[model samples]
Target chain A: MSPSDFLIIPFDDWVNFLVRDWLVPNFRPIFRAMQVPISMVLKGLDDFFAFVPMVVTTLVFALLAFKYAGRGMVIFTILGFAFIDMIGLWPETMTTLSMILTSVLFCTIIGVPVGILAARSDLTWKIARPVLDIMQTIPSFVYLVPIVMLFGVGMAPGIIATIIFALSPIIRLTNLGIRNVRTDLIEASTAFGSTPMQMLFELQLPLAMRTILAGLNQTLMLALSMVVITALIGAGGLGLTVNTGLGRLDVGGATAGGVGIIILAIVLDRITQGLGEQKKVETTSLRQTLISLFKPGAPAPAHAGKAA
Target chain B: MTSKISVKNVFKIFGDKPGHALDMLKSGQSKNDIFEATGQTIGVQNAAFDVKEGQIFVVMGLSGSGKSTLVRMLNGLIRPTSGEILIDGDDIASCSPAKLREIRRQKIAMVFQHFALFPHRTIAENAAYGLKVKGVSSDERRERALLALEQVGLSSWADSLPADLSGGMQQRVGLARALATDPHVLLMDEPFGALDPLIRKEMQEELLVLQRTLKKTIVFITHDLNEALMLGDRIAIMKDGEIVQVGSAQDIVSQPANDYVAAFVADIDRGRVFTAATVAIEPSTLQLADDTAGDAVRTMEEENRSAVYVLDGEDIAGVVTYQQAAAADRDSGTSDVPIADVLITDFPTADRDTQLADLYAPASSGLPIAMTDADNRLIGVIEPEAVFAQLSADPATPDTEPQVEADQRELAPTA
Candidate 1:
């Protein structure tokens, strides 16, 4: 035996054996239960994207982009969508959108409450912080190994892997947002005799909405990147197009797919970022929102038009 | 009179083992000794006082002197390590969370130094916060909040957000929020401390004016001796976690309990704290309505006075100067035309609680300022000599010497 053999522990091999033999067998029922929601959401998004005509989907996105962002973003979204459609990658783009949106939905649902719980309890925060650090630091491909082992390969497993990779930002930011809520406001709420739940909903949550929305934006971006990577596991999206193009050594096709992703990322990033910007403002009047964007020196929104 | 809020032997030690620290404190260990031995910080030590109803009770101390902690304990915010805080007969130290909330909801309202306004909410909404927390209906909350805003003279800005208002106006909104709840007690923790000096003065005057009609039992906390003297009917002076003295403004300024309290008192602007009543001296003789001009002259000569109040029994009918009395005597050619003929009603009269510094303007009318009771009876008079003596006696040399010089210069032209 070589001298190096003495130091080699084979820790990874032992963990792999334990996970395959013990964890998978013992948690079969839990994994089975998780599959229901996962498949249902995946199917729902896939079918929804499939049924919508390409032109109609493009118009809807353009309209949303104009409403939240402005005229500038609307033009960008239209150009992006038209270019993707012209390149014959419209379906793949739609599937990718569906997967990213699905990941974002699940991450927000699971991350926010956990973040609030962690913020409220020091013990929970100590535990969640290290787990989040690890989740963020690990390579995205490592998550695929366990996801594939538990659920096998397909769009469902791909979606699960995207969620695992993207969930860290939302949880971490939500915890930070809640923790950073002004101590003065909290004391004021307590002095005014708010119930614990009332303090959470009326005071803490409203104040933290901007930071949490920023977290959501980060999560969305992460999920977008991870969805492309998940294409290696039979997930159908622009990632597949890019992957196939790369396999055949077709640089033109790969470049086209990369352009489509850049367009989509820009559109999605602008929309989520615009949502965060809107929260900094007190007024929700469409006229004011439009006016303020162009005229930086304009007065703030009039009266109490804050979104109740 | 029954005390509205009574704090008895209250102690607040902040640390992991506050109970052990409290036991050590009770066993006659000093705050520093306990802190050194057990790593516990004493927030307040053996603080005992009574806040009477409708009285402005000020707790004044420098930062880290435990004044804020003591006020917070009254509302059950900082739970005392030992002893009792009784608000209207209920011990707040032993209150459960719900009961404590109820007390805060219905009995006490606190105004913070930073205003603590919700930046996202409208001024009306901020004003109505307390009412909303008490589960008042929206319509009623709106109406009451508007009325409170009106009281603070901010009705026009109700729809504006807190960010839109200036700092002083925002603090007014904070006051309006507390008033909207209509609680019996107001706990103001240096509410005007963040304001500009001019605005701070205006808010202090505004609070005093509001107190006149509101009659809320106000426990005001401040690091300013001037503010404490200005606002408080009774002042409690704290130092290093212990209440060294508790009394009226006069009591604190005149008779500080120890050297620490004396140092605090020394920094006080005494002209502001000592009112006309505190410095006024009783007249030796008065001109009666029936007293003839000759009789008035004899009394003035005996007392060596330039002027005297003409009394209608206990009421101040008017003032009769020696010149006016002498001219009347010469014109009438007798001392018996009645003192009413020479009685001059144009002289300035001051109330007992009027600050001595304010007496300058009224006293500048070249008249001895008469101190009057609520019934307008002449109680005493403030002479230039008495005013200068008190001014020069002030331990705060900077505030006194200049003011005395100015007063001397202002009178020099007249003299």
Candidate 2:
């Protein structure tokens, strides 16, 4: 074959070459550097004092429930949050909480709109689907390399990697939510003389909210799990303590952090999934359920034949 | 009523290769060929219709029949492929986006089948959404929303979010939202199509009541024929992206234009449409002529008379029409009942829109209903002779008719 006719490498092949040659060799040093900034962001939160105030937390959580679930949900959330605290691990848990929350917030800010765009356009879905695939499928260790390159170690790098890995579900769910919004409902909003903005805010977004919440729920859980892996990049939280303890053969400290992660995961996941499922059950049309609910036999209204 | 909506030849062909699809179809390519070649689907086709002002216009068909697509075209939800949709004489197709927005906000509102309640907002907020979207102040939105909820009997549920409400309650909130907008026209695409049968009926009646009070011009879409008959002032039956027939339920049922139209009528239980308003009533017999038989004979055989309603001056008299009894071509065996002895449902008639269940008698076949003025003076008779002629064509061997004819045959004609 002529030299001009030769193909050197595909992107995937090139990617593998880079990971094997440059990425693995340089990754450890970058993770060592991420330790500083991640620690600073987390220092104030210490898990216990780090709490964003129970009242504020309660109110925010309550508002979320009122919107997506129902009123009684707020009470359960408050109790759950308090119980997790009463069990101690306050400062350690708070540090982990801060990491999870911040990671999720940034993820949402990026993920939701991408999902919405995906839902809106076929091209968007096609484009976004692959990016998500890469983000999700790439090894968790592989994520540390990019984080290390940008932040050069510490909590920041860990946060970045955590964000990359855990955020896929958020984007996926958001897209699912928007796409799942019933076309009939959207048309209904438009026919009602709703402006584009109104239709978005009133119908499309609201109906899709359940799916979006599910995405959020999944993302939060993913982020929580990844934060520990991010500890390898010096993003200190419960993960740091766990990793360090594991390194030193101190099973007690590492186990505590692991337990804390599980608690936070449970608390967050339950609340979110509950809200999404609740919204699903609740939003079905009223007139239909009532007549169907009461009895097998009901008066067939003559006017039903005439619903003009 | 003026025609509020006018659609002139609308088509919506969906595909990457509409031209090729249309060409191949014309060139004897089947649907599979069109699909394989272009990945195209026809959404709606050459749909032309109008809705009169203050009239309840219903579009009905089964799923994928393009009925929903036609409704979407009304308010520009989906622009037609090639056509002009005029609302109040203004063609919406060429209108500016700003104007379309204005028309939607000020002129049209839709009630959805799913209710589409906002889980984030309370009933009042969902109800007030259209107004809020229209830039109405908070106070007015809330006030109107509350009032709308009250109209739907959901005033107490106003503070509740959709999640707290039942499906039917949420639907009430949906209605409240549409009402809050106060648009000149309300478009409902299967608004109650999702409800259970009983609740669907209740909602239907509720809509009728609301329309009676509000008098908003309504354009409703549904698949159920009975719903169209009960709710529509006029119904437009859609099939294969075209309106097979458009008329009152009685008109469509009694006078179907084709097989497709006949199919719709056949599926519906005719007990409701066959009302006293439909059967012709008696006319006055004020002539003081002494010869009763001679007079009856002369009146029966009058030249301009297709059918005469026998009546005693605003009071009903016996109806005795001659349809097949005096046809140019009649079956020899059935003609034995002389024209005079032939009893017809058209002779002892009521109005043309009478309820079948109302006139429950031992026998009401071949009985003609008389049409009379308010003073009880007979004017005309609605003879069932036409109905009889239709059925009596082959009485010796009554072929399989639908359940409706079997049910209706139970009410025998009585003198």
Candidate 3:
């Protein structure tokens, strides 16, 4: 016997028994309820991506990149989509996009409010900090077993696991951003008789937008990285393609799927980053940007269009 | 004048279980002793004062003296552990949160030390924030905000972000924000403390000018004694979480309540703090209608002075110097020449309330300065010697004894 045998606890067996005998039987309905929303969002986004024609999708994304991220991003988006289509990985890439989008949507809906609560109350932060640390630190594969056991091997469960893995940063950063607002500004708001709700929505949220966007960027990247690990549970996407290619030892196919994910990640990252990194002084509203885009003599859009 | 804000025996203890700390405080345990026992810091202790309507009541102290804490309690920003804060006779200290918020919105507004203009907002938006929190309509908010900005001379910068403005302009925006609400009371916590001395002086003057028309009851907090003297109608001086003295500038300078207040006022420029009336003496007069040039000279010699004011009834006819009276008597070859003919009428007269700082130019003429009442009758004379003596007296040393004796003598006749 090894030193490990000195205190044998049977922790793995306890977890296994807990999942198989108690949790799966008891919490199955609750888990199914959880999956319903994720599945509905994932299916809607997935079907929408599948329904749009390839050229129209490419042109629309290219136009968005041009409008938001400038000429360099527009050129890259168009060429990158064309390369993915040529390699016949467009459908798989679309499925992966939908998965990432769905994970982000649910993460935002849950994470932001939790973050705000944590920011407002010390007790909430005390409770949330440890859970967030665990979610961030645990290996993605360890939770896969329980997720598969509960929701059983599908796209929705994979996306659910992706959300769990990616949720921490958004919550942590949102809390930090609101907490970091200058004390003088907070006092000024309070001195002016702002209700707690008005303070949160009008002052705190607007001031913390850049930091929250950065958190969203981080969450999206984390969700994207979870794609292949999620594919182990039979989720369909470029991740499935990559896993299948790896199982067959087809290096060329695996490289093609890996390249497609990289291209899609780069496009998403650039667009979101551009949204956050606008000039702080002289911040133009979205309406202003839209108006300028359509204005006859607007210099930025004209220059961007010419460059494209 | 009605009391707009009345704070009675307010105390603020910062920590968990403030109730226990408050109990210790009420039982006469020292702040440090309670801190050692319970780890609770007393921020303000037994603070009480009444701020009259349209009065600038300045609370002045160095850092960590709890002046800031006392000011914050007035608006319910920091609730007091025990006591009453009555704003217009409504006890804000015991009011519910909703009622307190309503009070803050409609009745009171504050300007912060660092000018706390929202970084992301336009100047007009920052100015309109108080009105916005009060749920004013957008058009009226903008209109009033622009008007306030115009009052502070920054209406043209209304569309620009706070980052685009200088520190002085940002503070003006802070002032404009407070003004936009048209509050009954304004709480300013070192609003100009962050500015350089030049801008601070300009802002102080601007605030005084603004107050002439606005006449809002203002509680101004500052660490600088000179600023307190300049801007405060009445001042409360705080030290170690207690108010040591509260009085007008002249009262504090002339008779500080304790050593702490004395030391604080020691470095202040007394000329600006004291009025001409404070140094004035009862004038020796030769009646213009009855006395001659010889009598004027005789009176000056008797009084051991260079001049005697010649009064026509109660009003000053003019002043006659010994040289002018003697010359007039010699030229006319008669000791009975009229005092009016020898009277020199070009001398400057100061109002009784004129600051001694402004009396320097007239005092330089080597003649006694007349302190006149509002009806242009000479109530007293501020001799050049008295002006120099008062200005040069060092209050920080034992030598101030002679000055105190002189002050007593000056007050004797008036009393």
Which numbered prediction scores highest in TM-score against the true structure?
A: 3
Give the winner by DockQ: 2 or 3: 3
TM-score of each: 0.88, 0.68, 0.91
Runs in model 2 deviating more than 4 A are: A1-97, A204-214, A229-233, A237-239, A242-308, B22-38, B94-98, B118-122, B150-176, B195-210, B263-370, B374-415
Tens digits of per-residue lDDT for model 3 on B1-415?
Answer: 7789998899999998899988898999998999999999999999888888999999999999999999999998898888999999989889999999999999999999999888888889999998998899999999999999999999988887787778898899999999999999999999999999999999999999999999999999999999999999888888889887777777678777667777887888998988887888888887888999999878888888888888989988888888988888889997899887778887778887688888888999987888787899888988888888888876654223222112122222230
Chain A superposition TM-score, candidate 2: 0.69
lDDT of 1 by residue, B245-270 (tens): 77777666766656666777786777
Docking class of 1: acceptable
lDDT scores in order: 0.85, 0.69, 0.88
Chain A TM-score values, per prediction: 0.90, 0.69, 0.90
Candidate 2 per-residue C-alpha lDDT over A25-74 given as tens digits, one digit per residue, 9 for 90 to 100: 77756656545554565554444445567667656766676655566766
Docking quality class, candidate 2: acceptable
Tens digit of lDDT per residue, candidate 1, span A1-308? 89787797888999898889888888867876786787788789989988999889889989889877899999988888998999998888888998899899999999999999999999999999899898888998887877777877888889888888899999988999999999888888888888888889888888899889999999999999988888888788899888888999999988988888889999999899988888775446788878878998987655543321
Which numbered prediction scores highest in DockQ against the true structure? 3
DockQ of candidate 3 (2 decimals): 0.41
**Overall local distance difference test of candidate 1:** 0.85
lDDT of 3 by residue, A99-120 (tens): 9999998889999999999999
* Docking class of predicted structure 3: acceptable
